[model samples]
Target: MKYDFDTIIPRRGTNSYKWDTPEEENVLPMWVADMDFHTAPAIVEALQERVAHGIFGYTKVPETYYDAVVRWFGNRHHWQINPRWIIYTSGVVPALSAVIKALTDSGDKVIVQTPAYNCFFSSIRNNGCELSANNLIYRGGRYTIDFDDLEAKAADPKVKILLLCNPHNPVGRVWTPEELRHIGDICLRNGVFVVADEIHCELTYGRHDYTPFASLSERFQQNSVTCVSPSKAFNLAGLQIANIIAADDEVRRRIDRAININEVCDVNPFGVIATMAAYNEGGEWLDALRKYLWENYEYLCHFFTERLPQYHVLPLEGTYLVWIDCRASGIGSDATTLRLQEEQKLMVNSGTIYGPGGEGFIRLNIACPRKLLADGLERITHILSKN
Candidate 1:
């Protein structure tokens, strides 16, 4: 417990979109994907040491950076990553855009699951690709991929890529091994390249295991690209450093070239330093953070179940975000952002913004102090009762 996650660090006036909002009254911002906790101390020390060196000039990524990344996956996930197969990117979203640009032609079709991260759609469109969404089947108190529909879309000649959000956002389903295999088979048979956006890969919980899409099979690995980072797990989104693991040499070169074209050929020098430090030393902090987030989630679930039974928190096995089905609240409490900001004095993500399947749903970021969480929920209950 060297790093305390319970303290709420002030982020206002820091150009922090997560905490910046025009609230005439007090507001609790549980919106945005960023965490309230400070990053690992090891990461801070690494970056500060870099800053102390004083010369902020161009950086040629050292072999030490790559070695740190290789060692991380090798030790924790048991996924052997070759340093050569790794391509550095400024961030995961930008990396997604680059992959879409590199692997397919303009106007080619790309598939993504809806109630998904909104960035994948824009990344696809930004690359001039026609984006297609296969909304997940919300059955049996959990989310499942629509494989029959997925294969049908992949069967189309125009379809060239499938963008996957593993440990999926909004719904929070960690696609199991069997699911990954089915998805890999569909993409492979249909001449579609798989781009797995596993940025949330390390934050999973329960018995779920994450299989890197590229690590599924030889052909799948050859035709796929995996985008991952320590941003989510380590709360280092500001670092803007992510790795694009490409098993195929040619695909690696194409993705690397596209990243170069985007003017982020080299990321923040400190970002690289912090990334290496994180993968090498932040494991214990990440593990601790997961336990805290899970507890926070349980508290939120219990609060809603007893005090606000009109609403329901979606079953989550991953991510610090808790998706709430406020359809039963009947007060349109799911305006969620509106209700949270105006009535409850809290700020949360509105589901409708995530695309079609998001309506009637709201995403609450639970990566904060328990005191803050309890206060936010208390305010919510008071508001609901008045309504």
Candidate 2:
């Protein structure tokens, strides 16, 4: 089926975060991670079929749901996921909190690379764990992890878990194999567990291959818990379902206990159907979406290179979001975002919000119609030119 990624869909008044510019200000809401594109037709059909049954009572995920997930990882990424290792949660963020609570006691240090998913800090703190920062460095419009800092942090006895973003968010980096190996080795050596968030694993573009940290080595598997969901890949965040896959039996048991204490049983019925449909039948659509997103990335890259030289767009390897360096223009991400909002009438997220070292960079969500993308760039161009 042909996906209409070209048409601009009106998403306002649906309580969409993307369309929401301000508490009251009307600006194009492209700041959030959710795609403007609709979910795949197969997923919708499956949900409709399930809803037609007219039973919305307490439900359990059947074997087929787990099988679909396994097949998806196996076929697309060449990663084998055991059906038994999967634990369902409402969302990955919620699951992160649960895992922190499950794995560590209060005052234990949980390491997270900053300029990461903002909620990670809250999740760590909410679990009563002390948050430790391993900030990524920004150079030439792209971000890279400081392994020395990370290694030192990991080696610390107080630091318990590293919440790693495989294909990292805000600043897109599909971490290389060597990097993953080194990190995994460090974690294993230090007896630190790594909670790898591979949620954006499927959205990678070009030659970048996302290797699940747990799947790398036996030691890594023993020391890692990989979190994944169809939410980011299949545009089902609203349905709120994610899986925590722990390859180790002990870790799986602990996570299961966490789920029980948190009462995470009975995932959204619609989410189950949507997830199964996505994993089982939405491969072609995903491939096409990746191509579309890659094109959007390229279009934005070329546009900035030619028309807006001062604003350097980092080479995006994955995700629909692009990290832009507004520093060269003598404006920080805060000023850039404010100017875009109050002056140019556009909505974009300030990089500083992502965390430390995120200053002077802004993240723009390019997951929209080409026309909208073009319009946004043009508006930005005009705003910059006038300045």
Candidate 3:
């Protein structure tokens, strides 16, 4: 079935964080991770059916929801997930906080790769844990793990958990299996726990492969907690559902206990139905979306190369967020975002939010209609050219 990815959806005045927040009426929001496209038909249908039943009350996560999740990872990524190992959560970010609180004590240190998802910092901080950053080595317009540095941080006794982004945000790297194994080894050796946030795992493009940290080895499985959801893949962020997969019984028990204590164990009716529908019936829609997103990436690259050669766009391996190096123009990401909003009425994420190595960069969300992407690019070109 052909999905309508090209249609421009009107989200303005819809209380959309991406579109409605800016005070400027003319501003076009190209920030935030949520896509502008509508969710898959299957998800919509499932939601509609549930709404038709009209009983909105307390809910229990059915056995079918767990089964669909198990089937999804096994069939798509060759990672077999036992239904018994899956724990429900409202969202991955909240789950991270809960996991941190449950596993590590206050004042404990958490290891985070720099230039990571901005939420990693907050999640660690909110739990009263200090951040031990192993900054990624950025060179030649790409980012790589500084393993020697990572090992050093892991060796610290206070560092009890490593909060990991599997296909890292902003820099857009789908970490290879070897890199993941090396990371797991270092964490395991140092007696540190791993929380693999794989929310964006299914959105990879081209030949890039995403390795789930838990699927690496029995030892790695025991050492890691994998967080995944259909939220990002099927555009169901509003549904607020995710899974925390822990193969170790003890780890699962602690997380499960944390879920109840935190009062986040209750699954919403819509999230449960939408998630099952997405995993079981949304494959074809996802496959087509990946192609469309890759093409959008290609278009952005070509536009920058031909019309605005000074701007450097990092190669995108996964996720629809495009990380661009704007240091050539001598503008920091915050300044760039400001000028774009004021000058061209374009809004984007300042890279500084992603942490240490993210200076002088900007992240643009390309998961929208091509017409919108082209317009944003032109506006960006105009603003940068003036600067």
lDDT of 3 by residue, 1-387 (tens): 399899999999889888889877788899988999999998899899999998999989999999999998999999998999999999998899889988999999999999989999998898899999999998887899999999999999999999989888978999999999999999989999999999999999878988788898988988999999888888888888999999999889999988998899987999999999999999999999999999999999999999888888998999999999988778688998899988899999999999998898999999999999999999999877765
lDDT of 2 by residue, 1-387 (tens): 377889777887788766754665446666888988988999999988988999899778899989988898888877888899889889898788788878998889988888888888888888888878898877655677788998889888889999998898878889988889988887887888999988999999778888888778778888889889999988999998999988889888888888778877558899899999998889999999999999898899899889887677887887788888777767678888888888778888898877887887888999888888898888788667664
Task: Give the top-scoring candidate (lDDT).
Answer: 3
The local distance difference test score of each candidate is 0.84, 0.85, 0.91
Q: By descending lDDT, how would the candidates be arranged?
A: 3, 2, 1
TM-score of 3: 0.98
* Candidate 2, pairs of clashing residues: 18-29
Alpha carbon deviation, residue 120, candidate 3 (Å): 0.7
Determine which window of 10 residues in candidate 2 has minimal summed lDDT.
Answer: 17-26
Error of 2 at 371 (Å): 1.0
Which runs in model 1 stand beyond 4 Å of their true positions?
23-25, 331-334, 383-387
TM-score per candidate, chains pooled? 0.95, 0.96, 0.98
Candidate 1 lDDT, 216-264, residue by residue in tens: 6788888888899999999889878998999998888888888888876
Candidate 3 clash pair list: none
